[model samples]
Target: MVTLDKDLASIQEVRDLLNAAKTAQQTLATMSQEQINKICEAMAQAAYDNREKLAKMANEETGFGIWQDKVVKNSFASKFVWDYIKDMKTVGILKEDNEKKIIDVAVPVGVIAGLIPSTNPTSTVIYKALIALKAGNGIVFSPHPNALNAILETIKIISVAAESAGCPKGAIGCMMKPTMQGTAELMKHQDTSLILATGGSAMVKAAYSSGTPAIGVGPGNGPAYIEKSADIPLAVKRILDSKTFDNGTICASEQSIIAETSNKTAVVAELKRQGAYFLSTEESAKLEKYIMRANGSMNPQIVGKSVQAIAQLTGLTVPASARVLIAEETRVGHKVPYSREKLAPILAFYTVDNWEEACELSMEILYQEGAGHTMMIHSQDDRIIRAFGLKKPVSRVLVNTPGALGGIGATTNMAPALTLGCGAVGGSSTSDNISPENLFNVRRIAYGVRELEELRETPAPYTETASINEDLLVDTLVERILAKLQ
Candidate 1:
């Protein structure tokens, strides 16, 4: 009898799925915009119907986020995301400029390899499927080991509905056995036209290094600055609501709180009133040890865990009503776990002298990490808000709203999306909130708009046989061409 190892099995699975997906993508490439949207609508509807069940499965399998909050995330991926992208054209003629003599046509990007995170498995699967199919690209998902069951079930539901709506079979595939080796194969596969990578920094970095075109996200360590002119109570409420939601699993969730010295007293009081527990110097030390591992990555055990759960893990006595944990700190570095991305119900607090000081501090913190993710500020002063928004390196500058919700466009009017691109500075290809449009490329059909000599301001008088010094001219042209080539 012969037995196969999991790694070989995983690699075989990846090859089979990609081959089938590539064929299906060929059929999708010929689909019309309306046909693609119809199939996506069916997929979205099926996801919405199974949201609760998938959410429960994700929570029970991974034991990361709250099941109830996952339900909301699933709904956002289904209805909200679908509503935002339902009408936008992603195929056929995207734009036609008669005056400019240019016509823009959308082309499918072929097969996409998606990397799913355990933190938001089901929701991420649903969202990626919607956007990928909307653009007429077939997708294959590599599920996180911790959330494989939920992801597989979600894929099954959506893919069935999609096929029912006339989408080609094998257009949406998920690996049954997902391993690191298998994921690498998926990313490096020649049939994979692009990779939509979302997960830990290591996995995202791996995607980029696989010699394939990829769009990835970096770690988020956004700070929420409570300016002096802001509504203190409302600001704190928004922070708590965001932090406690899914136990801070979202990468866009605020990792730290910054306040002007003038508003420090009121901010702290409001934070305390609304279910925040400030850790003492001793307690902070205890929790910091568990926030990150010896190698400095976020500890998976605490990720998406509630304050009570984290406190128990760290052997600290935290109140039952505490929605989040706070640790006042004056330092920022990878060595200091509080200053890094915790991805749990833990926040670091800092105080600045004024708005300008707050701005400087925020910039410094983001520079330390999360250079192109998100930042939040609460202020009624338009001038200050404008100034604050100008210099930040983050992709999104959320104002007067929860970072988790606002960054993902649930609260803000930015595009409703699950994958938020961090731009070039954050190691992502684009800064846009990723949509179906992002999954396809635009091919420009352009007409000759001008004469060749019109490229220069003053034309050398046009005559076919007017030049006299042919030998000298050829020598000069050859030298210039050599210079340019060199």
Candidate 2:
């Protein structure tokens, strides 16, 4: 009875939030780009100012990721994202082509349903709010229950700042009482224009199935391939740095390392030199059992955990200096936990005979789970880099950089985003990095370039046409033949 009451309350709360968001979005949609920018600036500053506090709150509430790293993420979501999108035009006439006599107008997609994840709850909220508002759209967040406090706190801060800066009230809101029914209601609501979902595969699938246009990101099991011609130490260092960043909570972080057999010795030596602890056969087996749940999903208890905590959980002893746990793995499947997305400071190591073999291995690993997400290759050879970029089934083929930072556009020229789309190949609607531009639609205005007679002037193939003239000629010939027969 209590559970039923809670669910009913959540559904009612979703309805209220949706109504408020719809009204706020209508007001926001009427504002000019400059006015929207002012509100976005205020919200970014507010989020940046409270970055540390919110990071600590998220860590304390969810017990995931490092507070220090979360601070960096918060800064990225606010300052970096704002800097990248501050100059952009998202309203009114965005483009004009004098020669073609065409104009492009940007249109906001109204209220956006944002699904916040537990790993980066506060930062995700800040990022989504910034992008949604930058596009002159209102956002209603469905926060992860585990990180509700941080999500709500971030939303409150941003909403206050935005309203103070001449933004409409209720432009940014979050579901304080989060439940499955509430989130479903929020997504399927008639007023919800789009869903920007960033969570597990099941949650993303649900978002797509909610009868709303959704840009959902899927699970990432990216593999970092260290070619023979690459800088072994630098590659290993970047991988370790990325995997250990926020304790490997980022989806784009590398889950496995594929190195050429010619460079296997050097790769292993560099990995060990950079604080990687390789597990024994027995240790790997023992840890594998705890990597996934009985139902084959990632175990929440081990996500974003430190090496020491993970060691304790699996009853393995390792040096205090260890930064990441490495397991030599050959198989790739859902049953093989080591070859899957661990979301912690853990890695699977594979050796290949050459770059070709390394490419095949990387493809195999990604196809097993993370296709159309991200892949990294460290190679000085431009040909090899281009080859991987052309053949790999990933949205981002990062070259000579950390997967986590590069994929999110911190170390690369790509758009900075918390939600990285995996594309249709990965069962997502888009392969973009989820920017403000994605939150809006464009209306094209084109003048008639040619006369209607010009279309009829072009000749078509005989087989392509079934015109009335041909039919009349055929009928005439048939009549003539019938008359001759008579």
Candidate 3:
């Protein structure tokens, strides 16, 4: 008896899944909007029913984030995402502009290669599956190895529900034995129509380089700016709420706070009152060492960790009630840990002279790392809010809301999604909160509204050019006569 190598077996598994997904996608592409909606509804309900179970499994398996928060994320991914996309027309004739004599037809992009991250594995799987199937596309997941079990379990639940609702068999699948080679095969597969990649920068880059069209997201280093006119206590509350939610596991959470100088003291007092521990200069330096790896990427060990856990890991002492740790900083760069994205219950504090300077600092922070991701501002002044909206480089400029919840559309009117596209500035293809609309292509049926004569000048019967040629002959003769005379 012979056994296949682990990598080889994984690669073979990917090929098999791709073959199945291809056939499944063909069937899905032929499905009507109602049929797709029924399958999506069933999958969403199943995921919602198993939300707590999957959330606990994710937390236990990956040892990241709060289980209760994971439950919220799961519910958001399942219920909120489905509700948002349930009524969207994604098949057949989507729209017809009789006045303009044009028709818009929705076409599924076909088989999708979904890359799930370890941070929000279950929720991401649910969200991806919902949007993919809602848009009439089949999905094959490449689960992060650390959260493979949870992701696989979620997929299994959804797959069963989907099939029972008339979804094609094998339409939803995950790589049980995930490997780099397997993921590469999945992304580069001939049958894979598009890649919905939501993970680290390196993985997104790999997906973009796989010679396949991909919608990949980038890292988020969102800064929450509290203008002087804002309510300092309420601003601090929202920022803390965002930073501490899921121990800051969500990439869109606030990474730092930029407060105006006039309100800096008040903001600090409010932050402290809300259980944010301000680190001393020495302690700040100590914690900086753990924020990022030696290679300059964020250290996974500190990601999704609580304030107490981060303090213990960095050998610092903090109050037991502290929900977040803050470090004062003035610089923004690759070497500046506090100025970068810390996916934990930690934040960097900066003071600017006024809103103008705050805007400048926000742009500097985003440009340093998380351009085209998200930013937030707590401002009662509409002018200030509009200014930040116009000047910020980020895709989502959340106002007076927790960056984590607002950026993910949980507390805002944006599309509910787990995969947030960072747009061109962040090297992504889109800047929208990814949705089922993004998963399908639109084919335009345009009528000929004008005749070729409308584009032409009726040729003027060639009389105008005929006169010019005739006049040229006369002028040539006169010039020749003049030349001979001279």
Per-residue lDDT of candidate 1, residues 1-486 (tens digit): 877799999999999999999999999999998899899999999999999999999999999989999999999999999999999999899999999989999999999999999999999999999999999899999999999999999999999999999999999999999889999999999999899989888888999999999989888999999989899999999998898889899999999999877889999999999989999999999998999888888999899888878887889998888888899999988798888887898999998898888888888888888989999999899999899789999899999999999999999999987788998888888888889989999999999978877776785785768766889889989999999999
Question: Against the true structure, what is every candidate's RMSD?
Answer: 6.5, 5.1, 4.9
Specify the poorest-scoring 10-residue window by lDDT in model 2.
459-468
Q: Residue 130 in model 1: shift from native, Å?
A: 0.5
- Give the range of the ten consecutive residues with the poorest summed lDDT in model 3: 458-467
Model 3: per-residue lDDT, tens digit, 1-486?
999999999999999998998899899988888999999999999999999999999999998999999999999999998888899899899999999999999999989999999999999999999999999999999999999889989999999999999998989988998999999999998999999999999999999999999999999999999888888888888998888888999989999999877888889999999899999999999999999999999999998888888888889999999999999999999999999989899899999998889888899999999999999999999998998899888899999999999999999999998888898999999999999999999999999999888997556554544656777789989999999999
TM-score of 3: 0.94
Model 3, residue 382: C-alpha shift (Å): 0.9
The number of the candidate with the highest lDDT is: 2
Pick out the ten consecutive residues of candidate 1 with the lowest summed lDDT: 455-464
